[model samples]
Target: MREINNNEYHQWIKETKEIIDKFPERKKSFKTSSKIPVERLYLPSEITNSYLEKLNFPGEYPFTRGIQPTMYRGRLWSMRQYAGFSSAEESNKRYKYLLEQGQTGLSIAFDLPTQIGYDSDDPRAKGEVGKVGVAIDSLKDMEILFDAIPLDKVSTSMTINAPAAILLAMYIVVAEKQGVSADKLSGTIQNDILKEYIARGTYIFPPKPSMRLITDIFKYCSKNMPKWNTISISGYHIREAGSTAVQEIAFTIGNAIAYVESALETGLEIDEFAPRLAFFFNSHNNFFEEIAKFRAARRIWAKVMKERFNAKKKKSLQLRFHTQTAGSTLTAQQPDNNIVRVTLQALAAILGGTQSLHTNSRDEALALPTEESARIALRTQQIIAYESGVTDTVDPLGGSYYIEELTDRIEKEVEKYLQKIDELGGAVKAIEEGYIQREIHKAAYDYQQDIERKQQWIIGLNAFAIENEKMPEIHRVDPIVAQEQEQKLLELKATRDNYAVTSTLKALKEAAKTDKNLMPYIIDAVKVYATLGEITNVLRDVFGEYQPS
Candidate 1:
C-alpha cells in the first residue's frame, strides 16, 4: 500500500467535489430522519489535518474508531436489557428470566417515586409506586432486587439521577450483606443531574446541591467502589427528547466536562474520578450517522480529557459507553415494524462499538415492554453477535471512504458546538441560560413539522397506510400496586426501631447542613432502614427544590 501525497489528496478532493456538484437536485437533497436538509455533501476535503491527528488508530491517543483495539472481536458488547417494574420479587423474576435468555448484564430501572427521593408510601408518591419501574424504599427492597443473583458476579446498571447517592449507598450496603466487598462491586449509576434538568425532568434538589451530590459519588466511588462507574452522563434522553445528533454529542460531552469541573472543585485530581466516568447515548434509525456520532464522541472526549483536563491515565481519556436504541424512534401504529427498526438501530450500536447495549422493545412506544417483546429485543443482539457475522472484522466499516468522511464531518460539527459552549462560559452557564433546552425544543419542533408535511415518512405513521388494524393491548400499571407498596412501607416502619431511624436521619440532616460528603451518612441511614422519603425530605429542607430560570 502506498500513501497519497498532498497533490494526490488534493486531486482526489477536486474530483470528489466535481462529482458532488454534478449530482441531480433530488440527490443533493440530504435529509435526516428528522427531515432536516443537509446543505452540502461532506467530503474528505471538509476535514482538517488537526482532526485527523486527533482521531488516531483505535486504542491509541484519541480513540476515534474505538477504545479497544480488537473491539467485539475480543468480547461481544454486553447485552444489558433494562428491566424493573411492580415489586422487587417481580423484577427479580424478570432479571432471572433475562439472564437465562442470554443477557450479559443487568440494568435496573427504578420508578418515578424512587428517582425523586420519595418512598413508596409518601403521599406525593401515591398512584406512582412501581408504575414505571421497581419501588425500592430501603435496603429490604434492595435485598429482594438481587435475591439470588450474586452481587460480586453480575454487573448492574441503575437508572436514577437525583437520589443517585442514596440508591448507590443502598446498593453498597446490600452488597456488603451479600458478602461482596465494596471493591468487588461492578456497575454504574446514572448520576447525571444536568441531563435531568435538560431532558428527563426527574431532579429534586437545586443544581448546586445536586452537583455536590454527584461529586460526592465520584469521590466515594473513586476510593471505595473501584470497579463502579461513577456517572453515566447520558445523551440517550436528549436524543429521545428529539435533539439532533450534533446536539446529543455536544450536550453529552458538555455535561461530562461539567461533572469533571465539579469533582475538581472538590479538590480531587482529574484522573481520580475521570476514569470511572462513562457515557450513554441513543442509537436512532440513522445508521451511518449514528455510527459516526459514536466514533466522533470517543475521539472528542479523549482529546478533551487529555488536553483540557490534563488526564494522565489512558482509561481516563477513553470514552467507554452504553447505547440504547432510541425509544422515540419506535412507532405505535404497526408495532411489528418496530422490531425491524430496533434491529437496525441495534446493529448500528454494535457497529459503533458500544461497550454495552439495550435494544428497546417493540411495545415500548405503547407501554412497558412485555416479557415476549423484551425477549425479542434481547434476541436481536444475540442474533447480531452470532449469526450476522458482522463482528468477524474489527471496525468493518472503518476505512470506508464515506464513513470516514462522515465521521470527520461530525467531529468538526461537534467541535463548533463545543467552541460556542466555551464562549458561553461552559455547559452550566448554557443550561442556566436555557440555551441547550431551546436548541432541543427547536429541533423537536422541526422534526414534528417534517412528520406533519410528510417530508419524513415513518413507514407505519406516514407512508404506509395501515387502517383498521387491531392494536395490541398495552400493559397498564396496576392501580393496586401503589396501595400494596404503601402497606409494605408502613409495615416496615412499624417493625423497625423508630428511634434508630430518627437518629440516623438526624445525623444525615446534620451531614447535609455541612460540607461533608453525604454518602457515609446515607449508608448509615439505609443500614437503619430509614425510608427514602425521610432521607430525601431532610435534604429537601436543606437544599430546597430547583426552579428552572
Candidate 2:
C-alpha cells in the first residue's frame, strides 16, 4: 500500500472542501454521545504518524486492525445467545432449541438470587427465584442444566460473579457426571467481581477476598480446565451502566490488569492463565466509535501483556472478546426500530473482529424477550453471517483513514483513563473512591439531558413524534416458577446426606478463615449437595459482606 505524505494529504483535503463548497445549500452535522458536532468527513491530513503506527497490520505489533491473519475466514465468530430463565428444565429446553437453530455456543444467564449467592429457598431469595433467569441452588440444578447437552462438544459461558467459584465448581461436577473430564470441557465464567463493585452492584464479599476468589479460579483453571476461559473481564455491563466508550475500554483493561497482578502475586506465571483471559464488550449504536473501541482495546491489551507484564506466549497477548449489542440503546417508544439499531451494532461488532457475538432482542426494553423475539435476534446474526457479504474479508474497514484516526484517538483517551486510575491506586482503590462509578453516572446523566433537550435525536423518542399504537405483549415470569424452584431446593436438602453437607460447610468456613484455596472446599460442598445459600453464608461469616461506600 502506498503511504500518503503531508503534501498529498493537504491537496486531497482541499479538493474535498472544494466539492463540499459547490453544494452551498447542503449541510452536515457530526454527532457524539454528548451532542458534540462532528465535521463532514476526515481526511489523511487529519491522521498523524502516531496514529499510523498504532493502526498497523493485524497479527503484527499493536493489533489495532485485528489479532489474526485469517480472522473469521479461519472460523466464524461464536454465536452465543444468552438464555436461562424460570427453571433448569425450561432453560435446558431453550438451550436445545438454540443449538438446533444453529447457535455456535451456549451462554448462561443466572437469576438475581443466584447471582448474589442465595439459594432458591433462602429468605433473601423469596419472590425472586427464577424471576430474571434460571435458579441454580446446587449441583442438582446444574445437572438439570446440562442434562442432554454434551459437555465436551459445546462451549458454555456463564454470567455469574460473587459466588462465581462455587458455581464454576458445580459446573465441573456436572461435567464429570456426564463422563467429561475437566480438561475437555470449554466455557467462560463471568467471574469479574471488580465490575460488580464498580457498576453491576451484585458483590457479596469485600474486594480483598473477592480478588482471592478470582485468583484461585485462575490458578485452578490453569492447572486443570485448560480449555475454559477463567474469567471474562467485562466492560459490557460497565457501558450499560452508562460509561463512555473510552471509559469502558479503560475500566475493562484496568480490571483485567488487576486480575493479572493478583495471579502474579499468587506466584502464577504470566503466560499460565493469561492465555485464557478473554473480554466482553458492549457494541453500542455509535458505529465508528464502537468499532474503534474494539480495535483500540485489542491493541492496548497486546501492549500491556507483552511490554508491561512481559508475557511470552502469543495467545497470552491476543485479546479475544465477545460482543453483545447494547441493550441500553433500545427504546420503548417504537420498539420495532430497535431491530435496526441492533443490526447496525451487530454489524459493527462483526467488522471489529469479535470472537463471539450476542444480539439483544428488540423487546428487551419492554421486558424479557418472548420466544419469537429471541429467535429474530438470533436470525439477525445468521443473516449477517450468511446473507451480508461483509464477513468475506478480514478487517474490512482496516485501512480507512477515518477509522484509523478514530482508533488512535480512542487509544489515547483510554490511556488517559488508565493514568487516572493508576493515580487512584488501580481499579480497587478507584472503585472505593467512587471515581469510576461517578464518571459513569455523569455520562449517563449528560446523555439523558441531551435527549430531553432535543440536542440529541433518538427517532420516535425525542425526534419523530408518533401517535398511540398497539404495543406488543411483554413476557412476564410465572410467579409460581419461584415456588416450584423453592420446593425443588427443599426436596434436595431433605434427601441429601445431612452429615456430609454439615461437614463440607464446616470445612468451607474453615478454609475461608485461612489462606487455603476455596475451590477444593467448594467442590466438596457442591458434591455433598450443600445449597448455594449455605455455602455463601459460610463465606459471609468468615469474609463478611461489603457495604458500598
lDDT of each: 0.89, 0.89
lDDT, candidate 1, at 79: 93
Tens-place lDDT digits, model 1, residues 52-144: 575567788778878888888898898999999999988999999999999989999999999998888778888888889999988889999
Model 1, residue 295: C-alpha shift (Å): 0.4
Candidate 2 per-residue C-alpha lDDT over 262-298 given as tens digits, one digit per residue, 9 for 90 to 100 = 9999999998999999999999988988888899899
- Local error of candidate 1 at residue 22 (angstroms): 4.6
Candidate 2 segments whose C-alpha is farther than 4 A from its true place: 1-30, 33-37, 50-52
| Model 1, CA-based lDDT | 0.89
lDDT of 2 at 472: 88
**TM-score of predicted model 2?**
0.96
